[model samples]
Target: MEISRKNRRLIHTIVFLVLPLTAFILFVGFPLYWIFITAFKPESEISSRNVSYWPREFTFANFGEAWKNAGFSIYFKNSLVMTLIGIVLILVVSIMTGYVLARYKFKGKSIVYLILLCTQFIPGAMLLTPMFIMFSRFHLLNNVVALALINTTFQIPFNSILMSGFISGIDYGIEEAAQIDGCSRVGAIVRVILPLLKPGMVTVAAYGFIACWNEFLFAFMFTTKQASYTLSVGLKSLIGEYAMNYGQLAAGAVMAVIPVTILFINMQKHLIAGIGAGAVKG
Candidate 1:
């Protein structure tokens, strides 16, 4: 009787937990596996009516084609430059805004918070027309710097609030102690608070990097020239009106995934900690 009951419980656990987890893993993992294989499969294997689980012949032609012929090299460079610029702008502004909100009391603070919260609800599409006109008037269309600025504009409010929460979690006494020890306000922040805020900084940077890197609609709409196109826009270019290059598309996707994946892997620990701390204090 005892052995039967233990067996039943074990069966229940497997049914309720193990089965669902395995299914979910397959559901997500299979597509990634398919794409990885498809990227290496030759052009003939890709367009065939017959589907194979594995590539019969693997080749590097897709990556070469995408990089050189498809102009992804230019797109990749543009994305790198724009993302780096946007991340720097985001970090600087969000940190300062967060520090103020967390450490100082000021008039209109509630109103500012309310405004920031409201901006999150505003859809990106709604601002597209106005931004286009504004950028056109300034002759900033097709410019990477302008793209970075727009990305920074959209990213700031949420990041500021997130940074504020992180700052709130830190004890004010630390900054005070630094000030008492002959450091100026900026000096204390530079020398003391920033080191302690590494986790929050990593969290913000990861979010900012993803946002800037994956931005598509803005990059597509604002930049008409191929030279200014980011990776997301470049990926869309692989689809023709009458034909699409599946292999190149898959190769481009793999390239796009690599950087963000590496970043997340390296910063996973700090990101988890920062999010948890911010959530509790926020």
Candidate 2:
């Protein structure tokens, strides 16, 4: 009788979870599965009326062709360059700005922070026209640097806010002690404060990296040169009017997702912890 009750409870739990699980598979999982299947299949299989979840044959040729033909080589390099520049800009600026906001108190500080936070409420799409005009004036319209700059600018608010919380959570006692020991204020921060903020740094760096990597709107609008194009733009052009080669497009997308997947796999632990650190510390 006890065993029967336990089995029934287990069944109830499974039934309750299964609906959402099935929904996820039908929606998110099925599409991703199709992308994977299509990436490996030949063009003939894709055009056939009968579509199966599994591929009849597999080939790496599609990936090789996509890699070479899609101009992703140029896009890949541009993306890397943009990602690095954007990350550096975000980290340096956000760290300094966050430290100031968290450590110092002065007149108008609250108002300043409020203003900064309010900027986040503005729709990014609304600013697109203004940004385009500004970049055009500066002759930055077709450059990867323009994309990196725009992405970093947009990302700064949230990074600074997160860092403020992280900085506040840290006790100032350690920095004070170091300063009392004959270290300068700058030295104390460098030696004592920044080291303890690794988790927050890691989190923000990951955010900056991912934002720059996959950003499409600004990248598409800003860069027109094939040499300057980011991966997202390059991938879209793969599906031209004359040919809707789903296999090659899927293969290109798979290639695009690989770097981000590897990055998350490596840093997911710290990313999760760092998210809570900011909220709890401040």
Candidate 3:
């Protein structure tokens, strides 16, 4: 007996796709699984050289300790507020800049873009000294407002460049037609352009939030006060001279990952819709 064509194809598919998919899943999911399980494990289990896949003992004390003793509660609130503020500013500025870059031609436009691109390659650590000095001079140190402003400044260049490409995908004829139908320039942009730009905006907003949320260097450097420290900074503070609490750290990480995961799941629908809409329009 010989294998049928269908059976051969099925074997090939399994070899080419299913095996790789399973491997990839295990590789990617293992760290997340380990961290999540570790968050529930007792300190003794976490420290032992003989590590088990399952927790020997589970406790909620880690989360409570993280929230209270580690100052994650304050850090979480500060991170949320700061990230939101940065995202808003980035969105507002990027939209206008992207629209202009996409729809208009002006002197130094290419040069401006080149500068923005170049700025992305510069080491943020290298800028720390000047930035700290500048902040100190302006009394902006240890301030969430200053942190938001710094995040916005660094984020805007890349985001605006990306949004310009997104804006270019939109048909300008719609805006022109709206203007012809008694819509003012501002109104045309507000009504026609902004609606079309929602997907790009959402995408950029998510990116901005993640960037600001994970940003440790600037946040660590600028925020000296516990009340102003972001989650990343606060997590770094969890490491002590003599004692390290792995469970509390893992719990804090899990807590931080949850909101971003929820947000991504929610926006995934819009991202799919955006792809479909683009395909239709194209």
Candidate 4:
């Protein structure tokens, strides 16, 4: 009877969960798997009607060719530099702003909060024209600094919200206790409150990193100089106006996806805990 009950529960669980699991496998898992396979396939096999579930013909040369021929090395370096710089700036600015919002009672605090929330309603595309003109006038186009600055601006409001929620969850008495122990206000934040904010910080950092990493429209619009091209822009070039090289395109796509995947995998536990904590506290 116990075994039958356990089997019945299992069947009900599968009935509810299996459809979503199957959809995820088909849409998310299979695409990643196909990219991995395609990254190693030859040019002919990639374009051919005969699709091998696994590569009947495999070549490491696709990656080598992509690395050398697609200008990915330079693109990868530019992407890394821009993403890192943007994330650092966003984190520093948002953390301080979030802390202030969470802890301080000031005039117009409600107005400030409302303004921050309202900014989220604006589409990123709406800022493009004004930003482009501003950057162009300043001759900042085609620079990684331009990309970093633009991305940071958009990231700050959202990140500040996430951080503020997390900061609010921590008791103000903690900072008060630290102050009583000879910590200055800044010192209390840096030495005590900041330490407690780590999980939320990690969560925001991952968000900022992925946002900058996969960002294309701004990168494409802002960067025209060959040296400034990020992986997304470089990947676009793999598809000519007329002809697309499927193999190299797939290889570049895989390259772009791999780093982010590995990063998430390594930080999976921290990310989950951080998100969960932030959500609960918020």
- Clash pairs, candidate 4, are none
Itemize residue pairs with steric clashes in candidate 3: none
TM per candidate comes to 0.93, 0.90, 0.88, 0.88
- Highest lDDT, which number? 1
For candidate 2, the per-residue lDDT at 58 reads 88
Q: How accurate is candidate 1 locally (lDDT)?
A: 0.89
Determine which window of 10 residues in candidate 2 has minimal summed lDDT: 273-282
The candidate, 1 or 4, that scores higher on TM-score is: 1
Error of 1 at 108 (Å): 1.4
lDDT of 1 by residue, 81-176 (tens): 999999999999999999998888999999888887778778899999999999999999999999999999998887898888888888889898
Clashes of 2: 1
Candidate 2, superposed: residue stretches over 4 Å from native? 1-4, 272-282
Query: Which candidate leads in TM-score?
Result: 1
Q: Runs in model 3 with CA error above 4 Å?
A: 1-11, 268-282
User: What lDDT score belongs to each candidate, Candidate 1 first?
Assistant: 0.89, 0.84, 0.87, 0.86
What would the TM-score be for candidate 1 when compared with the true structure?
A: 0.93
Listed per model in order, the count of residue pairs whose N, CA or C atoms clash below 3 Å is: 0, 1, 0, 0
